[model samples]
Target chain A: MVRPAMSKEGQRPDPESDADHRAFANAAWSIPSYLLSGMAVYGGLGWLLDRWLGTSALLPIGVVVGLALALYLVYHRYGR
Target chain B: MSARQLLAAEGGNEFQAPGTEIFEWGPLWHGAPSWLTKPTLIVALSVIIVCGFFWAAFSKPKLVPRGVQNVGEVGYLFVRDQLARPLIGKDGDKWMPFLMSTFFFILVMNLMGVVPVMQLPAPSHIAFAIVPAAVVYVLMIFLSIKEQGLVGYFRNMMFPPGLPAWLYVILSPIELLSNIILRPFTHAVRLFANMFAGHLIIAFFATVAYWFLFEKLTPLGASLGLLGFVMTIIMTAFEIFVQALQAFIFTLLAASYIGGALHPDH
Candidate 1:
């Protein structure tokens, strides 16, 4: 494993890497929650729509759309 | 009496796989309140143990540290450098007392699962896990509001910059639910589910070993019993790793939340 260069005093010379690692971890952990919440919110709306319109299709559509939107959100926020 | 005769006397020869009943404990003693179960006792003991250990380690500071203080410094530095500093940025050290206590406390509670007498991890009970997660949740919200003004905090959380105005309509609710509702729920469940499942698995293997080796020790069953015994040992070792990891993750997430609150832009 390639270790990051350390200062003579033995501290990590690059604090940016530390921050980047932390951000990566935070983003990774948050992804699942974002996906689940997205599914719940949209799929739930779709369910209500299906009940009102007497069509059984919107729930799955809603779930898919929610999932896509969630992915897009993650990409927009973290993928950069 | 032979194992066969003992099995015959028991009337039910089938092995009973350990289940949720292993997780449930009736009080420590008769007439004790229903709430005063083993998990609760372990939680109380964890609190005392953590406090006592830290007190012993830090009560009298030595310029050249020795013994307990050396172990204490290692723990302190582990939380400070690995958890607090990396996640929380410059303000990390300020939160050491809270972060360190949370890490060690949860670590101890999780470790109780592998301990001989206290074989239940307190956080395996959802309630124990929830208390700490909820505390962090409430603290996060409070800190967010305090650091960022009330409206600013909600605005920043609900609507991230660089996104087009129209996208906020659909995306904002996801952010709201993820941040406000699901974060703590997942936090608690992650610890609870891991410990609960780990305990159940260990208990299952232990029961298998006991039943096969002693209760009904057929020649074929002896090898299976040995396997169970070996697995029980292996799982216990794995559980210790998992216990420590969960504690680290729990504290890391808590620090991240606090860091986010303190520095919303980050």
Candidate 2:
């Protein structure tokens, strides 16, 4: 299912490869965890920053940045 | 038993909620038998059942399969085709025994919850699920370290091959947190939560049925009891599918972890 998303590059298409299926399964399970961990680590950092600096805005900002980072990480590794 | 008594004690006025006391247990007997608890017994029974089934099936290899072998072959094929081959891809055979035992043991353990006269699922008790998750985590760590030297494993895991160097500082923590900490936690909790909630629902309905129909019998109450009884039956069937599925997923993830350790994405 994910194979069709491969963009038009010079790369040879091996849609039926075992490695492709394995990588697909790995990514399927993995992406959610990446998002969660990104949220957790950055959100915690943001909370700490709020506590230390007496500012309330960092928490939401941190979560957004964390989410973008996580999405970018997934794209760099799997989607691209 | 206590729910009925408590309701009766209330002069049959209001329905008393079934409490968490349902999970509590005293040892089966005094002295050395103190170790004999429902969860403990269920786990042991599940282990024996798994081993016994496989032993019977493959005790003597026949040219043409018989009863036990036929059942065994079906299970073996399921683990191989569905889990090992698709998830692990190459060098998957070596992990078959671990995956096979894990799938069957968990399946049997989960099924025990629905079985009459022994309705407690062992894995629902978080500890049962944690042990396997820990073992798989240890195996994953070990395999990764062994296959790719210690520093290399850590490098590959945290810093995926082609990412810019500066991003590693920001992202390595995410990778570490996800792989090292969260993976095992989720691995154990997924199976545990599913079984726990399934058992809780089944128990709740069963208690309702027993409490309303047998103890406090009334036309209105009997209808609720019948609903409870019907839900109990339906949930039990649903629980069977859930049980098998959870087992399959647990095993599949285990294989995926090992495979990832063996061959990281280049």
**lDDT of every predicted structure (CA atoms):** 0.87, 0.83
DockQ scores of all models, one per candidate: 0.33, 0.28
Show model 2 residue runs off by greater than 4 Å.
Answer: A1-16, B1-12, B30-33
Residue-level lDDT of model 2, residues B87-142, one tens digit each, is: 77656767889999998999999999888878888888899999999999999999
- Give the per-residue Cα lDDT of candidate 1 at A37: 90
Residues B68-182, model 1: lDDT tens digits? 8778877887787788878887668799999999999999999999999788899888999999999999999999999999999999899989988999998999999999999
Q: All candidates' TM-scores?
A: 0.92, 0.90
Poorest 10 consecutive residues by lDDT, candidate 1 chain B: B1-10
Which residue pairs show collisions in model 1? none
lDDT of 2 at A36: 89
RMSD of each: 4.6, 6.4
Best by DockQ: 1
